[model samples]
Target: MQEETIKKFMYMNRKAPYGTIYALEALEVVLIGAAFDQDVSLAFLDDGVFQLVEGQDTDGIGVKNFSPAFRALGDYDVTKLFVEKESLEERGLSPDDLMELVWEDEDDDWAEKPSIRIVTRDELKSILGDQDVILSF
Candidate 1:
């Protein structure tokens, strides 16, 4: 059954892109959320930040690169991609180092941001105000 009542949503991806299915699963969830016509937000945290690392090499794993799917986020209207600034700093990464469309501001104008924004964890948790649902991927 489909739920027409969905309003706002935020997804927290908290694992490494490889060595696990979290990254791929999260991407699928984002796609489905968009298909449902609900507002969606994706936040990358912890080891999950690896999903955005630029110049990924998955050939050794014998799997296609999943980074390209991330770039399609905007195409599906799942444009609110977020990254915990601290997470990146801790991992020594910058938004420029990742793949896909992400926000640089709360209103990064999903249609115009050249690159994704880097937000602090506190800022992320705070902005999540009144979301109908929060899913951790």
Candidate 2:
């Protein structure tokens, strides 16, 4: 059997969820990349933190809300979600303002656990340094 080379891919989301399509487009790429069985991780920074914010209502607009897609990432085996603490603070938001996202850990007896990790800006820098490839939006 041929061994598959698993490269570390980090998707850097730095835009707001609505108004522009960058956030949604980045999400589509992440979902596609997950299928290849590569080591995937998503970093939510700047206005990107708004993407995971709870209680999103797109009713005023004619667009369908796609925020729920973040909740399904676990099913695709894409569980590493990193949110920048500094970014949230700058935007006057906290962890409580975000949705509680969980994923099933098959190795841990199929246990459900939170998938989002709130990290400092310095920590995020370290994470970026460790990634083999980074797709920034």
Please give the CA lDDT of all the candidate structures: 0.77, 0.93
Best lDDT among the predictions, by candidate number: 2
In angstroms, give how far residue 48 of model 1 lies from its true place.
1.5
Q: List the residue pairs that clash in candidate 1.
A: 15-48, 52-98, 102-116, 103-117, 104-117
Off by over 4 Å in 2: 1-3
TM for candidate 1 is: 0.83
Which residue pairs in candidate 2 have backbone atoms (N, alpha carbon, C) closer than 3 angstroms, thus clashing? none
Each prediction's RMSD over C-alphas, in Å, is 3.7, 1.6
RMSD of 2: 1.6
